[model samples]
Target: MPEYGPQPVERQLPTEEARDLLDLVREMARREVRPTVDADEEAGRFPRDTFRQLSASGLLGLPYPSEYGGGDQPYEVYLQVLEELAHASLTVGLGTSVHTLSCHALAEFGSKEQRSARLPDMLGGGTLGAYCLSEPTSGSDAASLRTKARRDGDEWVIEGTKAWITHGGIADFYTVLARTGEAGPRGITAFLVPGDAPGLTFAAPERKMGMRGSPTAQVHFDGVRLPEHNRVGEEGQGFAIALSALASGRLGIAACAVGLAQAALDEALRYLHQRRQFGRPLADFQGLHFMVADMATQIEAGRSLLLTAARLRDSGRPFARQAAMAKLHCTDAAMRVTTDAVQLLGGYGYTTDFPLERHMREAKVLQIVEGTNQIQRLVIARDLLGPEEG
Candidate 1:
């Protein structure tokens, strides 16, 4: 497959500094992430040291303020770094992306005092964070969540279970969304919950088909007390905050999907040139050449969609709908591209001997997480027609 996108109409080309940063990140991924990912996935081991290294390299807070010890780069630059990281190791890329979403809640909605006190530690990479929004009964319909938080004198007592929490048990802090008033999106509020807060506990991590290196669990909040100051924004603003964060998050996932698809294409192309059948290289076979062509075409189309959405974000435009389209298209492309890559490898693809099978497994989760593709389509359609259509 050709494995490159058509020229983007709205390009987010890196500046000189951003390009340097990407080069450094790419070098690190090649040196550190590439070699260890296979073993880490097999053992389901989270690479704490690698995360620490990434933090020290200023990657953890790439787009945040420099005052908080971040690199303060643009989203365009930040996402490309994420792409390279994902191409080398999906686990690290996912963890980084989730952590970034967690930070986005605080950065965008936090009071000055809240940002000053918490952003330093969180953005500095000393404390990893997670966002708690999904519930057992509510995944896509997040506003229908039942988790409640009632004001009690000087504190709010939070009570309920948050499902599918990435870094549930291991994160140093959590950005929790809970129902604080009536019975819909308008009643929900966001709060910053410390990891050691009383009455907070984690269910055992769910064993998954892929992305096992990123821990996920259900978090129970039973009368967890938070000082009034911990609230992220005005009451009833949680849904907006979450939606905004997710818009950006969708772009991150789109970038990751493109990176994965590209990796699969590159691997397949290399193998085709080397692996032989019937006294000739596989690439020489006209039948397989057509298959490669399809894979490349899909990957490029995915890239075109993803970059278009990302540029909308960089240009400060309302991009939620575009982001949904990008996430849906790119992730679906990744699933197809990786699956075909595995098939190209024939019997060896089914084994753990190569990364194609692992990539295929990893691609499935991208379709599920962030938002399911079904939800993404709904989001796009609602925006295209009108909010009343929702």
Candidate 2:
């Protein structure tokens, strides 16, 4: 095994108060989330009660302003809490992260009246949200979306379909992006559509290989009517808002990926110490020890990158490139770490008896969602080389 050096120092450490918050979050994860995760995943159960508990604990609105019943925690602290939740269950972790991203439109760009009317229910309790951006024809190329929103007097009638919405049918609200102008990305606009809107409907949840507990569906808006006040930001600004929201959402996914990797590493380490082979502990073998070392090193590096991007966000610095880099690196690291975890577990890792298989499955989706790793690379390259070349 390679001789490991001291772990790199964290540029910013959690304060005592932040540590206490993390403890509370970890306690919730261990007590309420961890035990139920496998069963829930197997049964395809959505943990509405878990989210309600999170809301009550003031976790649902972490990083938002306290005036709106949020914890007003920094993004760095908020991401750590998300990491803890994800270490327990990727379903809940990803769902919460998506919900937070859905709220960004209203919180950052909605009119005062819109915020007053909508944010309390979303940020407080009893309401979950979904962000609607991707369409069947356009996943990576959001500029090519075909969903239409037409203005008529005081109402905008939305007619389109959104694919892969995380909380499609179950959410209380949706932040929908629709085409409202000429063509391409500039035509897009966002609207806050109630789940119970008359013309809104959903397909059955997708049957996926992982994160089965969290619902994913196709949301159809067949002339869904919304008042003009529901529009979030200026019409052309929707794409910008969506991009901004996604930049942050990518960080959330990165944090969740790291958490998943950590969970896998912990499980493998525990099993390695206990599972004897060839008259010795599995951890004693040189080859396995080297693998374990690599997993730990990758996790620490992912954590460093995630926190760096989060701190940049909290400081109100330009961090789109950093966020993309973190998301790409962390999720890629997760895929590698989780795969090795299964390898370490031997036959048990391939079976549903252990959580490593599920972690591996969940890690795959993190690489694809909130902007694919390819897209992240593009974002980074654009940042470094300037958009004229892009």
- CA lDDT of each candidate? 0.88, 0.91
In Å, residue 270's CA in model 2 sits off its true spot by: 0.4
* Best-performing candidate as measured by TM-score: 2
Which digits, one per residue and each the tens of the lDDT, describe model 1 over residues 1-390?
754322222334567887677778889998999999999989998888888888788888987898867787877778778888888988898888998999998898998888888898888756789999999999998889999999999999999999999999999999999999899889999999999999999999999999888899999998999999999999989999999999999988988888888788888888888898999988889998888899888877877777777777878898899889989998999999999999999998889988999999999999989999999999998888877722
Worst 10 residues of 1 by lDDT: 3-12
Clashing pairs in 2: none
lDDT of 2 by residue, 45-156 (tens): 9999999999888888897877666778889998888888998999989988999999999889988787777787888776899999999999999988999999898999
TM-score of 2: 0.96
Q: Report residue 92 deviation for candidate 2 (angstroms).
A: 0.7
RMSD to native, candidate 1: 3.0
The per-prediction tally of clashing pairs is: 0, 0
Q: How close is candidate 1 to the true structure, as a TM-score?
A: 0.95
